[model samples]
Target: MSEARLPTLFIPHGGGPCFFMEPPRGMPDPWKSLGDHLRGIGATIGQQPRAVLVVSGHWEESQPTVTAAAAPPLIYDYYGFPPHTYQLRYPAPGAPRLAAEIRLRLDQAGIPSTGDDIRGFDHGVFIPFLLIYPDANIPIVQLSLLASLDPAAHLAVGRALQPLRDEGVLIVGSGLSFHNLRGFFTEDPRIAADAESFDQWLTQAVTDPDPARREAALTAWAMAPGARTSHPREEHLLPLMVAAGAAGEDAGTLTYRDHIFGKAVSSYRFG
Candidate 1:
C-alpha cells in the first residue's frame, strides 16, 4: 500500500519455459495460475520502477556477483523445451550503473562482490518477466546467489541491497516455494501433502509479526515441516531469505499460492 517505496518480492519463476510452451496431452494448463499472478504484478505495484534487481535461484557464483552488461542477452538455461521457447525474446536493457552500485553497497557492507559483463539473463529472470513486464520497458540487473547456498548469507545480501527499494528499484527473488524435480512428475498423493505441509510452515514463518523470529525461522528453514521433501536442494528456497531480509521491519504477505504439477507453491510480497 506504500507508494513512495517499492516492495520486495519472492516469486516463483515457473518451471523452465513452461509459459511459452503448451502443456502435455491430458494435463490442464499448469502455468495459468502462476502466469496470471505474474501478469497482474505491474498493476499490483501501482507504478513504474526505475529498475528491477532480481536474485534468481538459477544463478550462483563463488561470491555475490551482478550482471554488469548494458544489454544482456537471454540465456535459455532451460532444456528439452520447444525451439521457439529458446527463441523467446525479452529485450530488456541491463542496468550496469545499478549493478555497480550494488557491488559498491555490498563492499561497503564488507560483502565481497564481483561483476559479470558477459552473463546473460537466465530463464529465471526472462521467463516470468516476459509475463510481468511484457514490453521489457524496465531495466534489469541480476544478482547471483553465493555458491555457499547458506540461508543467512543470502539474508545479509538482501539487507545490503535494501536501499535500492527507496531508489525506485524493485527487488525480486525468483524461485519456487516448492521445487522438487522428482516430486513434480510423481503421481503419488503424498508429495502433495508434503508440499502443503511445507507451505503451511513457510506461510507461518514468513508472516510472523516478530521480524527477529521470522529471520530465525527462515535461517533454520531446513527443519521446517516437509522441508526436505519440498526441496531436495536448498537453492530454490534461499531467494526468500534475501527478500525477507530486505523487508526490514515490514512483514511479508502471501500473495499467491497454488498446486502446480501437484505441489503446493507460493509467492510473497513485503513492503
Candidate 2:
C-alpha cells in the first residue's frame, strides 16, 4: 500500500527566540500558546514525515535556492535578545538528496533553482521546528523565496514541488500572517480591527472550494481589507501562496488562531 500524502502547512513563526526565553514581567508570552500548537502539529498530520521542506520568510535569493548541506548549521538570525539565544541549537540533519530532487523538479518546471551546501537554518525554520520536533531527528531542507517576491512565481514553484508530499516530505511555509515589525511591539486599538479584517479575508480566500477562485483571491490579496496594514511588505504573506498552490484541489482548514501582542495570527493546513 502507498503511504498517505502529507498536508502542506502555513505556520506563523513567532518573533525571534521568543520560544526560548521567558516573557519579560508584565508582558504576555506571545509564543507560549503558538509553541504549544506547533508541538501538536504532528498529531494533526497523522504521521511523521521522512523530511521537511521549509520555505522561510527569512531567506530570500535572486533565484529559487535549496539548502544542500549534509549537516546544516543553525543561523542565529535575530539580535537584541539574551546572549544564550545566540548559542541555541536544533541540530537536525540536512536533506541534501531531497534538495537536489527539488532543484531538478523546479528546473523541469522552468523555475530554475540553485543549491547551497553551506546554507543554514534561520529562525524562521528553527524557531517553529524546535517546538514541533524537539528531538531534531527529521532531516530538513530550506528553500529560499525569490527576491522579486512575486506571488505567481512562488505559487508555480510550489506547484512544481507538490509531488514531494506524496514522497513523504512535509512542505511548510514559515512566516507570520501579520508581520509589521513596528506595529508588533506597540499597543494600538486599531491593530485588532486591522488584523481581523485581513485574517477574515485570508481565511475566506484559502478555504474557498474552487481552486480557480482561490488562486484568483490569493493573486490579488493586496486588495483585501487591511492587506497593506497587515503586511507592510508582502514577503511574510507570500509563503501562503506557495502552500496554497501545493494544495492543488485540497481544501484548507484553519488549524490555529490567536491574538498575539494585540494582533491576530493564524495557521492553516491544506490537503
Candidate 3:
C-alpha cells in the first residue's frame, strides 16, 4: 500500500540564518522558541519527503513560475550579517525533472506557468530547508510568487499544485507570520497588541472547521488588526494563501506556531 499523503506547509521563517547560526544577542524568548519549533518540524513530518517544492515569498515574477535547476546556487540576499552567513550553504540538489512536472501539473490544472532551469534557492527556501531537511539530500525546487500578491491568486496557484502532494512532493510556503521589521524593535504597545490580535485571528481562521470561513478570513486578511503594520507589503503572507489553497477543502492543521520577536507569528501545514 502507498504511504499517506504528506501535508504542505507555510512557515514564518525568521531573520536570515540567525536561527541556525546562533541565537542573536538580546533575541526575544518567542523568537528563540520559534527557532526551536522549526527544528521540530522535521520530526513531525513522520518521514522524509522524496522531494520538496517551496513557494518562497522572496522570489516574485510577473507571471507564475517554478525553479527547475538541477544544482541550485546560493543567494546571499541579506546584508549586515556575519560573514559566515554569506558563506553558509545548504547545498541541496535541485530536481529538474520535478520542475517540468510542476509546470505540466500547473498547466493541467489550468494555471499557466513557466519553468527555469537556472534558478537558485533564495534565503527563504534555503534557510528553512536547512533546518527541516538538514541532510540536504532531498531534491528541491522553488516556485515564484506572482507579482499580484493577491490572496485569491496565490490560492489559485496552490490549487494548481495540489497534485504534487500525492507524488511525494512536500510543498512549503516560506515567509514570516509577523513580518514588520521596523516594528520588531519598537517598544510601542499598540504594535504588539495589534500583531497579537491579527495573529489570533489568523490562527483561528486557518484552523476553522468550516472551509468557507477559513477562506473568507484569508480573503479579507488585509483588514485584520495590524495587517498593514505586520505585513507592510504582503509577500510574506501571500505564501500562506497558496498553502491554504493547496489544502483545498480541508482547513490545514497548524503543526507549529509561536510568537516571535514578542509578536505572534505562525507556521502551518495542510493536507
Candidate 4:
C-alpha cells in the first residue's frame, strides 16, 4: 500500500530571493530561526514528492492558470538586490506531464483552467523550492492566482486540485503572511499592531474545529486590527484560502511563526 497523503502548506515566502543564497539579508534581525524553519519544511512529508504545485500570490491573472512547461526556466523576478543575487540559480526540472494532470483535474472539477507551456518558475515558486527541495529534483508547476482575488474562488480552485495530493503531489501556497510593503518600515505602530492582531486571529481560525468559526474568522479577516494596513491588497493572503481548502476538515498546525520588522507573521501546515 502507498503511504498516507502529505499535508499542504501555507508558508511565508520571505523577502525577495534572499532565502536561496548564502545568507539572507535586509531584515532588522538575523532571521536565524526563520532560516532553520524553512530548511525543515521538507522533513514532515516523510518522502520525496513526485511533483509540487504552487499557487503563488505573486502571479495573478485575469483567469486561473497553471505552468505547463515540461522543463520550465527560472525567473529572476526581483529587482535592486546585489549584483551576485542575479547570478543565483535553482535549475529544477519542470513537470509537463504533471501539469497536464493538474489541468485535467481542474477541468473535471468544473473549475475553468488554462496552461502556459513556456512559463517559467517565478520567485514565488522558485524561492521556496530552493529551500525545501534544494536538489531541484522534484518536478514543479505553478498555479496563478486569479485576478479577482476572491477567497472563495481560490478555495474552489484548491478543492479542484485536492486529488493531486493522493498522487504524491505537494500543494503549497507561496506568499508572505504579512505583505504591506509601504508599512513594513514606516515607524507606524498601527501597522505592527494590525499585523499582529490579524496574525493572532488567523492562528485561531485555522486551529478551530468548528467550520463556521473558521469561515467567520476568514471572512472577517480584513477587520483584524491592522489587516488592511498589512495587506493593503489581499493577493498574498488569498493563497491561504487555497491551502485551507485543500486541508479539507483537517486541523492546521503552526509550523513556523515569527515577526519581520517587529510585525507578527506566521506559516501553517494543514493535513
Q: Each model's TM-score, in the order given?
A: 0.97, 0.97, 0.94, 0.93
C-alpha lDDT (0 to 100) for residue 4 of candidate 4:
71
Q: Report the C-alpha displacement of residue 86, candidate 4, in angstroms.
A: 1.0
**How does each model score on lDDT?**
0.92, 0.91, 0.82, 0.81
Worst 10 residues of 3 by lDDT: 22-31
Residue-by-residue lDDT tens digits, candidate 4, 136-214: 8888889999898777788778778877788888899988788988877777887788888888878888888875567
Whole-model alpha-carbon lDDT for candidate 3: 0.82
Kindly indicate the candidate among 2 and 3 with the higher lDDT: 2
Candidate 4 Cα misplacement greater than 4 A, ranges: 20-29
Worst 10 residues of 4 by lDDT: 21-30
- The parts of candidate 2 lying over 4 Å away from their true place are none
Worst 10 residues of 2 by lDDT: 183-192
- Score candidate 2 by lDDT: 0.91
What TM-score would candidate 3 get against the native? 0.94
In candidate 1, the residue pairs with backbone N, CA or C atoms under 3 Å apart (3 or more residues apart, or in different chains) clash, namely none
The alpha-carbon lDDT assigned to residue 115 of candidate 1 equals 96
Summarize candidate 2's per-residue lDDT along 195-228 as a digit string, tens digits.
8899999999988999889888998989999898
